[model samples]
Target chain A: MDFELIAESLPRLAEGIDETLLLAGSSLVIGFVLAVPIALLNLSNNGTVRTLSSGYVYIFRSTPLLVQIFLIYYGSGQFRAELQAVGLWFLFRESWFCAILALTLNTAAYTSQIIRGGLQSVPWGQIEAARSIGMPGFMAFRRLIFPIAIRQALPAYGNEIILMVKSTSLASTITILEITAIAKKIISATYQPVEVFLIAGAIYLSLNFIVTRAIMLVEFWLTPHLRVDRRIPPVVRRTPAPVPAP
Target chain B: MELSYLGWGDAGWGDEFARGALMTFAVATCAFLLSLVFGTIFAAFKLSSNLLLRAVADVYTTILRGIPELLVIYLIFFGGGQLLQTIALGLFGYDGYIDLPVFGVGTLCIGLSAGAYSTEVIRGAVLAIPRGQIEAARAIGMNQGQRFWRILVPQSARYALPGLGNVWQFALKDTSLISIVGLVEIMRTAALGSGSTKQPFTFFITAFLIFLVLAWLSQRVFLRAEAWANRGVRSA
Candidate 1:
């Protein structure tokens, strides 16, 4: 209800939004790149490859991302000497790197599943037709399968993107000055938890709204054939009226 | 630094970790139950003919689903008390430091989040029920309550089981976030143990393993429940 407090905090919170977007955007890109190979492993003909991919997915999905973050960030301290020897200690020491690493790993697990589902949904007949046309296996997959699979997976991937955005808030616990962290800082400073959180919530809500809309737009573009023209005139009924005598 | 740090003794944190795991289960159960209650109500509202009620449900699910669970917890934990104080002042004019316990607030926050997802699951399950089955029950002179209990509830349960299982897992994982508000659940126990012992790796790895065990066990239970629910039904 304190308009002045919310107004004063808005500028500070904007920077937090930038950090949030950075964290989410970078992780999503990395996660998607990682997911492709994992998804392929999931759909592999070899049992070991499939099982290994699924095991990775299960481990990530079963544990909370917060725990994973803590394990990588804090747990890595135990191996500081080994990590330093391998030149990886500096990355683990930075909270931002740890957050991104955790997020990417988590999202890769879920995204791989989504991608696998999409890949499986591609009809066998389509691949058969591609093969009949003498297309190479890799070319057929690259040109014919991948496009359809990605289109099929777009909606679920959009949901994953939104989740990743929301998850960036957890980075605050590790001292990342993301949106939620800034809001918490403001609340601590001004003692107006309600106002600051409301403002923060609105920012998140609007950001998600835009993301949802953008996803819908992409979906619309991907499936133009599915959209029906509502303005088209209905077909005229040609049945003759019943006789008055009847 | 030593494995004995995890042993059950005066110096080790074994007892604390065990207690934390129990508390985590308790919170997850309470929150899941609360979520089902909220979900049923909102799902009903969504399926109703009333436009206003449907809009309210839509807004509730959208806002809750979009926001991070961490932010939601912080808002409720910090603002819930203030809101309660304002209500007390306006109604009974009694204003003192009214404290809402951490457990209650943590359950409420996670419950609200879980409810949003559950609402969709329940609504979809209800919609999946065949319309003719309900109509047949009505034709047989069964009342609304009987029809709901005998026909709708059983059928929906079978369809809702898998989605509910996923929600349960989500609630269990989300309890980790409650540690931010100082709830001594598994995550918090690990944090405290790590900070005190200066062996962050050991404590956190222990916490992760505990969670994996819980998740694995619960998954088996849910799978069994799903099988039980599907018994005698022909598979497509």
Candidate 2:
């Protein structure tokens, strides 16, 4: 109900959206890059590769991201001396780097699973057809398998993206001044936790809404053939133009 | 740095960590139960004939699902107390502090979020139940309550067990967030221990192991439950 306070806080909270987006966007990009190979490894016939990637996914998925963030951010402090010796302390020392690193790893685990499901769902008959046409292995995978798998995975990956966006708020606990952090700051300043949180929640909800709509657009684009209009025939009128001509 | 720091009794945080684990279990259980109740109600709303009820359920799930759990927790913890105090002042002319317990707020927040997810799962499970069975029950002159208890509940529960297992895992992990509100859960215990001992890696790694064990054990339990639930049923 404190209109003036909420009005003053809106602009400051808006600034944090950039930080939130950057954290989520970069981590998602990196996580996807990491997920592809892991998903492939998960589908591999080689037992060792499959086990290793499965283990990676299990460890990351089973643990909470908060502990991972703390472990990376604070745990690294315990290794500062050795990291500095290796010239890697610079990366470990920044909360942003640690936050993104944790987020990337956690997301990669989930994404790999999504990608694996997609890959598995790619019909073996399609791959066989590509092989029968003399398409090379890598080319067949890239052109035939990968495209189908990605389209199949897009919806689940969209959910993952929303999750990662919401998760960026946890970085606030690590001293990252994202929206939640900014909201907390405002709450302390004005003693209006309810108003501040309402604004912050609305911002997050809108961001997620946009993300969901964007993903749905991509889903629609990816599967145009699945659209009902695409399948239905257009209606035509015969002999109606003769009267106009007369 | 000494191993004794993790030992039980006067020298270590072993007792506190154990107690914290118990608290985590307690919180997760309460929240999970609350989530199931909320989820069932909302799922019914979603499946109801009324447009208004369905829309209300949709909005509830969407908004809760969209926001971060941490912010929700903070909102309830801080804002809930403020609202209660204001209401007390207005209605009873009382000018006293109203403190909502952190455990209640934490459970409510986690329950609300988890309920959104559980709504989807339960709805899916309900939809998975074949209509023919319900029809058969009615043809046999079974009452609504008997049909519900005998056919609908068991079948939907079988279908929902796996999803509910995932929700339980989520709830367990989410209990960690409660530490931010000063609850003496495992995460908070680890934080306290690490802060006092200046051994962040040690305590956190301990916490990680504890969570991993819980996740592993829960997975086993769910697997067993799934097997039990599917007893005598043919697998596709």
Candidate 3:
């Protein structure tokens, strides 16, 4: 453990955090946008629609994300003509676009499942009550169902976010110089794997810690009903001593 | 577009991919089995009354789970050999440039990660076992070893199956990371074929399909095992 080396490399590695955060943040946002509809499709009344959506989830979930990244990045080179004709070639040509495309697709699959689980967990009785009140189906879903489901799903989605942050490391293989990629470069140069990786690992762990803490805050905010009034301590119950005569 | 590019022998990359797939399977299997060992040990540590043991297990799992799996592989690949060399030199005054086989490195890294997960699974399974059942075994004058073997192992194993299946899928996927370190697994083979043949789509898609098949098959195997484990137990 060379302390000096760590001190020197810390600044360099810190620079890469922007890329890491950008990659994870953008994909999560885009993936969430994609996930909402896929989740609905997953829970559709029609079997064909449900199966089609689920098949997308299954394939993405089953295969390694690295392969998926490669299939988009390197794999797109083979279809250059078609992609050019469709005007997707420009996006495919850049590693950033390919990486984000792969990541967005991957996270969408996982997020849909998490959303589906959240949707399933929303009580049927609540939905029925909304229906009885003559709330339109869309209104019921928007007002009664979506909020409760999202609150239920937030914790799991937090886990998924952490996983996505970690998944961003795979982007390094495609030449995106994120934190892990920077760590690899430093280690290769310094021949000090243990130290460089330890630093890199610390960065990731701390990033995850911050993300989780933020999610916890979000969870706290979202579930006001669940949040006990911690500001006021519970009143201690007391039994008055038996009075001789009252 | 050239179908024969995947044909067997000198004509194509079929044989290479097959061999690579086999290597991937072997690595995943070995890693998974190794993880079970680490999981049991750490789970015991975690479940122990001793504070030090519990802290050790907690740190192990948290650190392993927090970092990216790719970094874990890099740490082990680059750090492990040096550690081994140091030990050998310290013990016998015999030191050479000792390189760990990529296979062992791949297995060890994946095993360590999967073990962190399995420790939670196994610990949960242990906790799920009814306390009264253990007390009854004690009441019957069963020895500790006898109770563990007869009651604890079987019951906790049954409970741990589903979680362990997820861990196995992760280990299987983690093997692809080994290709980054030149393990020559399916991922590596695909990368090579793609680079050589200039058919990136073909090779990468094949790799993806191969993984899909492996994942599907293992999922079935896990389901069957779960059924077998839960046999004669009431569904309700």
Best by DockQ: 3
Candidate with the greatest TM-score versus the true structure: 2
Poorest stretch of ten by lDDT in candidate 3 chain B: B77-86
Q: Score the docking of each candidate (DockQ).
A: 0.78, 0.85, 0.87
- Once superposed on the true structure, which residue ranges of model 3 sit more than 4 Å away at CA? A228-246, B84-96
Write model 3 residue lDDT over B1-236, tens digit each, in one string.
77789999998999999999999999999999999999999999999999999999999998888899999999898888778887999998887888789998889999999999999999999999999999999999999999999999999989999999999999999999999999999999999999999999999999999999999999999999999999969997
Candidate 1 lDDT for residue B101: 93
Model 1 chain B poorest ten-residue lDDT run? B1-10
In the predicted model 2, the residue pairs found to clash are none
Candidate 3 residue-wise lDDT, A145-217, digit = tens: 9999999999989989999989999999999999999998998898788888899899999999998999999
lDDT of 1 by residue, A53-72 (tens): 99999999999999999999
Q: Model 1: DockQ against the native?
A: 0.78
Q: Give per-residue CA lDDT, model 1, range B91-132, as digits (tens).
A: 999888787898888999999999999999999999999999
Model 2 DockQ reads 0.85
* Lowest-sum lDDT 10-residue window in model 2 chain A: A237-246
Q: Return the candidate ranking by lDDT, descending.
A: 3, 1, 2
User: Weakest 10 consecutive residues, lDDT, candidate 1 chain A?
Assistant: A185-194
Q: Is the docking of candidate 2 incorrect, acceptable, medium or high quality?
A: high
